[model samples]
Target: MRQALRQLAGRVWWYPHDEDPDNIQGGVAVISDPAGSVVVDAGNSPSTARRIQAAIEAAGLPAARRLIYTHHHWDHVWGACAWPEVEIIGHRAGARILEVEAQRSWSHHYLRAEVEANPRLGPSFRGRAWAMPSWEGFTVVPPHTEFDDDLTLPGGVEVRHVGGQHAEDSTVVAVPDAGVLLLGDCFYSPPLHLRQAGDGYAADLVDRLMSEYPEGRYDWFVDSHSPPRSRQSLRDLIVSG
Candidate 1:
């Protein structure tokens, strides 16, 4: 039960989903510069979106002018409905996945299942029922701009489509100046060493990441659910995987 925005790098920040049990485990990242801020991933609900927005404002940073969806998971992109004006960015396949999930009312069914699975959180989240935003009221808001290959941001940051083992639309964002690379659920850590993409894993994805981001290429490496690591550590994980 914690809610705090952590500054990871000079201009990078992370909002750990702690206090809100319903939105637990879905963290959000933000990369800010003079131009504006780029949000790595949105959380599971509008309340989470508002919290991230407040954190950004409290830090005296600029508005979240750009959003990068790491993948099509509900926890990652569901918060976009709160800010329809922002320019969302992600791989084309990611947009397609969102569309399918929206049509099927994914969030409602998913939350219900989670309650049935975990009696602890099933009781309530922040004194409320463990429920997500209404599927009808929620929209999958596809990326305003979609990319097939890699897209270089205004500040030399690169968002490359490296879907191999994770979701086919999985993207790895690299901040050249900051020497930080963000891997969004492409590589699962710990006991669950396999990729968590519902679509299944792609064996060569790790090899591709290794070749693209060798040692010394990045100083800090961040994944969707794990703590940040050094360049060598990340590279080794890929190799060992």
Candidate 2:
């Protein structure tokens, strides 16, 4: 998937999921600096981490000094264990989710629910369909650094505090000066995980982003499940502009 959709927005690049019928996006943002390169948001799976690393290599950046998880969710943080050398960073709120949610969240939601729902999850899930993995081996670590409102990241990127509407710990990395928003599951085209438990908060988050940010002027809008529904939802807001 990273091979198929490696679209770059200045210092940041996106890798999308082509194999997924759901068309979710799991990407790494590469922002280069003299110090080194920083990759944002580790992908959902180990395979995804490999692809993202390959893409980063293809982009011609040296080994990344750090990786940042946009938010702490199974699809986002699970793969961090795949990349050990890179120092991970996130907001305090996100850091807690990584630590507190308990691997139980991962077991109940991802390993159990999704795969049992479909075999496309992988053929390895054949007879052990009901079998689930334990998060016992998993180690959840908090972000080394936490920020309150807005923080300027390398490459002139602004990591903004998008507090309301989305998950209680949602974070939005906005290149406001550049008109790009690296939203982490805030808004997507067909609506990423729309049917999940946080539908009401998710809906509010959608309204906030659409009403707050500018329209197509932004060069790119990136998200974990960055879907077309995001475009349409924001387009309505643009009309009011």
Candidate 3:
């Protein structure tokens, strides 16, 4: 699918998630600043990352200076190789996870073997392993800078670690000046592959998000897999879900 770069608010632009493709991917956000753009998530593969880069360039946005990872999932971080010049950043725990993932072989055969041996290696893994155009030079680049709680980048972009059921290293990025908050899967329930029988939302994390960034605090709530939502809409979905 030809995904266009859509502006979320002021200087924030995002490439929406694509579920139509065999290799489903998550949304990627870009916070444009004079210093350089701050990108959220590298992408699912080199091709995906390049597409993101192309979109940014096409929009006349600044080149990416820093890549912020919401977590160390393949769909979110494996595309780092495409942006070799950008400084990568993420949660310390997420950095540790990527460090371990970096050592694993990404060869098609190896990935297939892994999925067969462990079902938890789920559809996400299977799709990336078999559907992406090429894994010939696949690489995993962990964050160069790590933070435990939260960090603010140049131009008032805030990244906060909000550990949850989706991924323990999950985080949400806020461009307060623009009234935009990018919730990188932090609000989602654990994927079926990783879920226990009664696994549900991480109550503490949900409470934190609700209270810390309540309605009116951010005009747009951008989730990795969904379209941007109104602050109240997200709150309602979270509460009802």
Q: What's the lDDT for all of these models?
A: 0.71, 0.58, 0.84
- In candidate 1, position 219 carries an lDDT of 67
Residue 185 local lDDT, model 3 = 87
TM-score of each: 0.77, 0.67, 0.94
Instruction: For candidate 3, list the clashing residue pairs, or say none.
Output: none
Per-residue lDDT, model 1, residue 48, is 70
**Model 1, span 103-198: residue lDDT tens:** 754554565676577655443332222335344566667788999998998877689887754567888888876767788887643112232435
Every model: Cα RMSD to truth: 5.3, 6.2, 1.6
Ranking by lDDT: 3, 1, 2
Q: How many residue pairs clash in each candidate?
A: 2, 7, 0
TM-score of model 2 vs. true structure: 0.67
